[model samples]
Target: MSQISKVVLKDVDGNVLHPQTDAGIVSVNDAAGSPSNVQSEIQALREKQSEMANIDFFVNKGDVNSDADLPAQDYKNGWAYY
Candidate 1:
């Protein structure tokens, strides 16, 4: 396993806010916070991931210059016209 040598806390002006300190008993594999809190966040994102991925939206080619600029509607018609 890899080890973190140092962690620097810096400010907006690139000034050292706190002195370097050893990371005591830190686990890289452990959850950031409480298990329940992490699980809830993961579940919420998983539920929305599929719904967001399957969203249907229109594809704007450009402004219609003339009658020929518009696409033919006789083919398979949907939000995406390409």
Candidate 2:
């Protein structure tokens, strides 16, 4: 079953600018008024997380020679090597 949610937005003066409900809960915030922004933020966060997940810090060099040879010694620094 689907739920309903109520969302309200008030300015500094406590005046309601936007009042809305969806599903079974209510979200009150500036982004709540425009859920697209929230979705975009979520997507951006997910992308950032994915990017961070693929990061390899222990590698000596970014380039690998035939997978058997170790990276050059010059690539020792964590950031510099990666």
Candidate 3:
């Protein structure tokens, strides 16, 4: 098993934002003028963490059937010379 590391971040107010987990803590901060962006980033990170925790099965290219053909007329065949 791989060892997990802990990460911590504190704002000027001295609040502990992240805590250590079984794997470790990953901390990120917002830029000077973008608190909303930071919140969005944190939300995305939580989603990814949830996905990792609940992952059951994974499929690789080898598992796909190769007999499938590309759809016809999906795009133009020629490009402009310009």
Candidate that scores best on TM-score: 2
Candidate 2 structure quality by residue, lDDT tens digits, 1-82: 3223344668899988766534223322333465443334454567789999998766344544466555445544664322
35-81, model 1: which lDDT tens digit per residue? Answer: 34333444456678878889765554545665446656543444342
Q: What 10-residue stretch in candidate 1 is worst by lDDT? A: 21-30
Per-candidate TM-scores read 0.32, 0.36, 0.26
Off by over 4 Å in 1: 1-36, 59-67, 70-81
Pairs with steric clashes in candidate 3: none
Query: How many clashes would you count in candidate 2?
Result: 10
State the RMSD for candidate 1.
10.3
Those runs of model 3 whose alpha carbons end farther than 4 Å from true positions after fitting are: 1-36, 57-82
How badly does each model clash, as a count of residue pairs? 0, 10, 0
Query: What is the C-alpha local distance difference test score of each model?
Result: 0.52, 0.51, 0.48
Candidate 2 whole-model C-alpha lDDT, 0 to 1: 0.51
* lDDT tens digits, residue span 1-82, model 3: 3334444666789887655332233334544454343345555577789998996444332222467544444433332111
